[model samples]
Target: MEDGKLTVRAVERALDIMLCFTGATELTLTEIASRVDLHKSTVHRLLASLEGKGFIMRDAATDKYRLGYRLWELSANLSKEGDPGIILLPEMERLRDQLGETISLYVQDGLLRVRIQAVQSNQAIRRVAPVGARMPLYVGASSKVLVAFAEPALHEKLLASADWPTGLDQQAFLQQLSDTKLAGFATSVEEREPGAAAVSAPVLDRGGRLVAALAVSGPANRLTLEVMQEQAPLIMEAARRMGTMLR
Candidate 1:
């Protein structure tokens, strides 16, 4: 247990050092130590280990450290076969460019909806939901879409067995899912986070099985319920393309 804790702590410090390079092309040893608030010798040792693994490299001529090729190569692999991001990223980018909002992809994980990929808006005041977050299946537009198209047994189990939030009417929620399935999309205004709103549509595989939910979200002041309603057709089209690409 002691050894494991030490290993984890070392990993955390290394990550802190790497994060100091964010938005920076290169950083000197002194700059890294200052950013992470660690001793010069400690920072140097951590940097040496990271450099050995190709996670970071120090330029001998300039004495500055920068991200290495290993990170870039690993990032490139996200687009390879069997990754959902590969099929959805192009459409996500197009939507972000056209709608000027955050585009995210979510898949149902058990009874919860987990964000798997995201293309955040470049706007200064934008909504940002972290990827890999497990959100409630009963709230938010993306969650509604995922639930609407979920497998019948699992869907029923979620409704009957899962603990629901207070003041949520069960019958009304079921009706909402029915409506979403009929319209092939879902829209919400400030259902999850205050001042945040989103619209989502279901993406199905070639066999017409529910695969994921593609959503566009932003500040409620800009991306209103009306705007999302008007843009539903386009969102649906993009989701359709995403579904088609999934084997």
Candidate 2:
């Protein structure tokens, strides 16, 4: 094969690895190697480079790999596709500055929540829910708000589907979603990821339609439930301000 073909094949394999994570957000090295049908050594090198470039991240506790934070910075820029989220960048940055934590924007797509934009915190130990990564709609703070504020059809579809991960109490989960909708916000501590906590609120358009869930996430130690509660108003205000910037 020509060198060009080899390079293209290499890029395709890397992309395959990224797509495989859609089904399994957290996967061990062996699991990924098996799923991608690649030699462990080859996959290891790809993962290493990807991690270095902030395209993938490894969980220290579980030794598993997941998506990382740099995708939006690379692809969601204003010029490339002109993502609507760019208009809210100033508000996201201000919230990050005021809260000292990662700020993320998540929009509901069917039963999934995709991180469309984010402004990460400066802390050395921080949570990284990668931009463009698809997350479970029934797991985290952002997910709760997204699901709660979603259209009734999509919301009911989620409630009826068996897509929810095991070990979750469906009854309590339903109640939580109800509360989130009523309160116009949600909070989670180590719910989606261990040692990570987040607070989230719905972003609504001028027509009173849900646009996204704006969130602040960081290490659980720093963003304890109490601290998040105290700062909840800040995020809610920022989310509302961002919503007004949109249609």
Candidate 3:
């Protein structure tokens, strides 16, 4: 092959590795080699290059590869060109009214979650998270919801790579993610921001891909654990409604 053709083929093979993660979350070297019909050595070389560029990440705990935060960032940028907040605003408003708390929409951006839109509470004392504010994905209810639905490989990668918050060890944190996924929602009290409480649910697109997290947050005193649990269904319902609209 010509030098130019060789370079193009190399790029295509790298993209193949990325494309493998579309419907799946993680893959081992052997699995990737088999799927792509390449030798394990070739796949390993490609994976190394992709990892170097932040297009992929390895979970030390599992020895599996997953799509990295960079990929999420690029995908987010594409989705932001046509914002979901416009379509979700009405539902967010309804949730805020129902709970008398603030409703915010969040999307994963690299290792952080960014608030894209929010409807503040009517009460005098409330948590006000400004749009565009970023928070660690390992902490808040909204962030946790995003992490819960994310690829298991991502969970492993985060545990192995990131500095977890105080009082949350790796196993406990993984269990929290597991529980969140099983319950279809997440709740946090002073996890990310002090004296703030929140309950969040996943918002998925028609294809069942996680599009964002819908959350209701307020002062911790007003939104206790029981209160958050009680309000979980409402937040979940609102997220479902938004997902339907997104579809």
Candidate 4:
């Protein structure tokens, strides 16, 4: 192979090693080398270079390498294609102003739900879950709403097989999913994190399939059953409008 071809092959292998950190928390150099089909010494050299650049780091006690905080920092700044999130920020702002509650847009990635956009509430007490935050499918209102309305195969698989961080029982989770669909939205009081209550409704695409979730969150005391019920229509309307633009 030419010099350029060898360089490209080496770069591809390095990237493969880096991609392994997406779902996994950490891996030893030997483990990474074996997965990538590279020599351990070569993997170590590449990892050292990536670590020096703040893309990877090793645990002091375990000596296992994982993605660095810098990787998280960088991923948060990435924009979606055509940047609908940026364009929709004003709409989120309008909803926040109207309701005085924090609003967010979440999308599914495999078994995880990622917050892609958010608008902070103007109330004295505000929920502070940041954009780029992610949680398992069975945790938050937004996550469950998405899962409930997703394809039945995916819903069953996630409810049956995927390990939820929240440790919720499968049967109970399925029940909640059923209720969320009937209500046309989801509401949870501290299901995923403490001291917060969230309401979420599905965001459909042009095809009217559930593609994302639109949510509002606040203190449990402030966001009572009546309040979330009132906000449901507003959230559903906003999701419908946004879906038109996304399509």
Off by over 4 Å in 3: 1-81, 165-167
> Model 4, 92-190: lDDT tens per residue?
888899889999988888888888889988777899757777787868899888898888887867856647445567788789989988978999888
The TM-score obtained by model 4 is 0.70
Q: All models: lDDT?
A: 0.89, 0.87, 0.87, 0.84
lDDT for predicted candidate 4 compared with the true structure: 0.84
Residue 2 error, candidate 4, Å:
21
RMSD values, in order shown:
6.8, 7.4, 12.9, 6.5
- Per-candidate TM equals 0.69, 0.71, 0.66, 0.70
Off by over 4 Å in 4: 1-48, 51-82, 162-167
Which window of 10 residues has the lowest lDDT sum in candidate 1?
78-87
**Looking at candidate 1, what is the lDDT of residue 22?**
52
Query: Pairs clashing in candidate 4?
Result: none
Q: How far is candidate 1 from the true structure (C-alpha RMSD, Å)?
A: 6.8
Model 3 lDDT per residue over 1-247, tens place: 6999989999999998887774467999999998889999999999999999899999999999998889777866664444788788988888888889999999998778888899999999988768877778888888789999988787877777646666667787778888999999999888777888889999998889999999898999999999988889888888888998885
Q: What are the runs in model 2 whose C-alpha is more than 4 Å off?
A: 1-33, 36-82
After superposition, candidate 1 runs with Cα above 4 Å error: 1-79
